[model samples]
Target chain A: MSEEKKRKKILEVKDLDITFETTAGNVHAIRGVNIDLYQGETVAIVGESGSGKSVTMRAAMGILAKNAVVNKGEIIYRYCDNIGGIDYNPEYDENAVWKEADILKMDKKWIRKHINGRRIAMVFQDPMTSLDPTMTIGKQIMEGMIWHYKIDKQDAYNRAVGLLKEVGIEDAEKRMKQYPHQLSGGMRQRVVIAIALSCNPDLLICDEPTTALDVNIQAKILELIKKVQKERDIAVIYITHDLGVVAKVADYVNVMYAGKIVEVGNINEIFYDPRHPYTWGLLSAMPDLGTDDERLYTIPGSPPNLLHEKEGDAFAPRNAYALEIDDKLDPPMFEITDTHSAATWLLDPRAPKVEMPKELKLRIERMKKEAQANGSEL
Target chain B: MAANYNAEPLLEVKGLKQYFTVSKTFMVKAVDDVSFKVYPGETYGLVGESGSGKSTIGRSIIRLYDPTAGTITFNGMDISGKMSRQTQKDLRVMMQMVFQDPMASLNPRKKIKDIIGEALDIHNVCKSAAERDEKVEAILTKVGLAKEHADRYPHQFSGGQRQRVGIARALILNPKLIIADECISALDVSIQAQVVNLMKDIQEELGTAYLFIAHDLSMVKYISDRIGVLHLGHLLETGTTDEIFNNPVHPYTKSLLSAIPIPNPELEKNRIALNYDYKTSGIDYTKGTEHLIDGTHYVKCTDEEYAKWTK
Candidate 1:
């Protein structure tokens, strides 16, 4: 914990706002989003579709759609020359210099040259669509390294082979000659990870990377990513709707609702002592194996349409415990602990206290008890 | 769940095999000798990973794919063979299916009313257009959708609403069995609960049985009375939900159950999935005969293997 505090903050997103100007209307996609990532921590941004989880990450990647307009805020990224990887450049800086750049303000050329693949890399959701069908997997993994690092072909080939091995692909030499179509979905995703790792990125942005694979394969992929992240000491920002994925991978959780972050906390706080009603709904909605309840707890309504500006909180209409003030004015982030806060009127000092569902409370207790019985820390 | 055991099954699949001919020289055996039964008012979950042929079995039972071998008996009548006109009409009213992708399965160009009322139109069940609209609206309302939504296209509604439309379409005929193939896989967590609750409510009120096919073990356990674990086109085990979950005999079933990510962070972090590789396991699935664990549980295995697994 002490060393973790000493680690540098690699990325910070402050008051990020984005909008999509469609033919019908202007859709305010992202609204005042804030996130912080240390050198090697995992922060998960979770929400339903159209809640702007992907848009926040896309903005960080500087790969937002052409129609998207970043009206406000900035993504500050800092990387040092000592960012250790196989492709480390010895000629750069003698003592290693820390560099900072606003991704929003940086030039496209500069981003493509330094930030895109060198410092930050992304593994998209669909491996099939992301990988080139025309090229062999080996050449595809080697292309970025050779182009970006100005390395020799033979050196890139050996590095690519080693990467494929690191991602758990066997018979690396034989598999390298295969095309994307010939490989299975799990193998293809592994190859995609290999390509992402080829750049030796300090920050890995995985946008629902394992959603396309099966459950067994998803577990393996998650493990592989965690292993790689630990080894590389890289910060990861995982964007997903699956609570299971988030619970398994995240060090901290960001609960997004209608383009705004409603809750932020560490894994234990978010899972065990969630303050926001949305987080409670999401956690309870997931069907655990040991639950005996006939009916699951569900959020009452859908997310609000982003095109139409609402009066106050976007989730107010759906929250059963919503206060009158929630409709009149948006609630600011209420600090629960040093690392935990919730943006909901329910967390207000003046508002009436409302607990999560009775059944859900029992379930969480059961989970904690079971965890203790299993000799695991909660 | 055992109450339905004494009653005859509504849908019975026996030695079902569905194969696809990739070329003249090679064929893909998607569903090989898979068998199970769905009794009235009880859900039978078919759980399997990708390429496990769970979807293939659903498609074959719905008669979307011609089975390569075996028989499908629906309500004690063989529907696997070439159908007569009356049998064909009976099949339409007796069994319906809700697909995975609501938007793609539903016709985009068609209005919500027409989409739900298509079965009625096919069978000429309604007396007039008003009667059809009334039936559509009633079913739509039953699925928790508004009557006003019937006029809009499938593209107009959100994902959960469209799935409600899909359920409405399948329920318009009031079929005895509804084959929901990964129906809630694409939905958000909160919406998933809503849909699951809605399905459970419909089942309670209408007494309709469901053949729920999905890879999500937690959801399958939640909704299913009985579960059949499929792996690589074979039915590895069949048992009551408790038996399959708590006393899984097959290594494949154990691996699948262990793969499910519990939502609790502490437990999830400590989860070490039991990995099962068929190539290295050295167990021949083809040589296995069905072995009984109990009245409600069965695992396919050779006698020698069965003795080891059961012990």
Candidate 2:
């Protein structure tokens, strides 16, 4: 990765904590989540259900459920209108962000005006919920630009068409005129993408955008996101449980387990040299087409109850390779490589040496074969 | 692992066609001319995307949805056409279904005892209310739920527990076959495996066949003996689970199999993104002889294309 290509930090989240006040108990959804978003880089937050990957991003976007409360975190955002071919560079002023506003502390009403959609846009998991069923795709796409940027109707329409084309939606004019219901699942997603990019927001947060889509449609949507990210050079936060999706589009990966990031590294490091046991369990459970394993492995037990306050490593009970120290004390993320870090006892010098699963070793061999076949570096 | 050709089929669907009348003139061919068989104690997997009528087939076989045409033979008895009241009662006791949403499938107002007991009551299995309660408790215990849980509501239980309740409800009838329509798709992955294992264990103990319908081909391969792929209201292909995945024939099946997001990062990056061309259409089913079919596999394509495949 070149330094020049190394994008400036567009958004920075620090020590984020969120809890949902439910009748059963307070559910600690996210804890001490720290993440950085560089301009034009796609950072994928991957995890299983209730792993708080979605909640973490939801907190950043100020869309957490009403029962939820953000106890700590500062989502520092720096926006430039130069994203969509507009030359509105403010000379990259460092103090400009603090001077302009505080997203975490600011009133949501104010945030909606200056921050939401205008500077930072989001595409949620289900397009049916995010998109208006009553309105035409064209109107919905143009509505954001008209409301936020005060852009003219024709220009907004043109921009919407451009976005539709950019997302690989053919016959933009016809697709725009059609209603959301008329479009297929894949097409509807593309329309949502168009709507998200209507204002040319600097940061695009896609929360499981392809989960509802079929596999074929999912591939197209992933490609569309990558295409848009590269073209617009906008920072992206891809939140999903599907690791395959993350691998295709994400430059970096964050593995979330029980409301905390168990591992964070570049895609290669996270996949090939994953240090966390939880990450290893996840990797091992996935069914390989090439593998001859009769039984598909599973991570034993369920995720920890969010209502119950966790004592040490949240994944310790489920992790087969968990050390005694893991249950007694929370392991800090040890630095493995410069770009790699994992929260696991395996990285601890004092911890007992445990080998990876035999299934994983076999999978690694297949992966190497596939890499060789594709003529690509693993 | 080819399907055991000589073995006696436990459940055979012949010329199954489920078409819903849209208004008066038009009919939505949700499931058109589909047929398949599940041998005794075999796990037959039905795999398809949404709108492929996978769930409809499961529902139809279990008598939850009446087929517009076709005959369903269970244990060599045809039960597809309009059934007599007594026959319907017997069918209800013989076959059961587990829906995708455990929350929705279970009755909200009814207690767990009443929910599981209803089937026994319908069948007149118990002589008295006390006997019914005892039976329900035994079934509850069999599915890994405590007998005390019989007093609780559906909302009181977690998703996995509720699914277990659904399983218990289906199993209490001692049905010959259970249609689990994406039953575990709504569950967490780890919980999904547990539920799957429980289903397998129950199958071994009770000798009940299963029509496991799901979108997850990988999981289907894990549980199913034979697999059938459905696409756009047509049965594209059918084969043994290993043969289906390892040596897929239909382009759609191959594409669908490849589309599954394998968790391996290296494989994922190299996965060929599927692109289908639905526009270059084939098939004139409207102009065809419009006769019912006896085969499990049906392909909606041009006659030439069909003939080529047959060759």
Q: Interface RMSD of every candidate?
A: 1.3, 2.2
RMSD of each: 1.9, 3.5
Model 1 C-alpha lDDT per residue in residues B1-311, reported as the tens digit of each score: 22266689898899999999999999999998988888999999999999999999999998998899999999878999898888888998989999899989999999999888888988889999999999998999899999999999999999999999999999998899999999999887678788999999899899899999998888888888899999889999999999999999999998888888878898787576788899999998888888899977999999999989877
Write one digit per residue (lDDT tens) for candidate 2, span A4-69: 654588788888888899998899888888888888788999888888988887777766689988
For this target, which candidate reaches the highest TM-score against the unseen true structure? 1
Residue A359 CA error for candidate 1 (Å)? 2.4
How would you encode candidate 1's per-residue C-alpha lDDT over A270-356 as one tens digit per residue?
A: 988988988888887788778677777788888889999898888888887888888889889999999999999887778887888
In candidate 1, how many clashes are counted? Answer: 0
Candidate 2 stretches with Cα past 4 Å from truth are A1-4, A81-102, B1-5, B128-134, B281-303, B306-311
Runs of candidate 1 with Cα error greater than 4 angstroms are A1-5, A81-86, A89-94, B1-3
Each prediction's fraction of true contacts recovered: 0.72, 0.47
lDDT of each: 0.89, 0.79
Query: In model 1, what lDDT does residue A272 have?
Result: 88
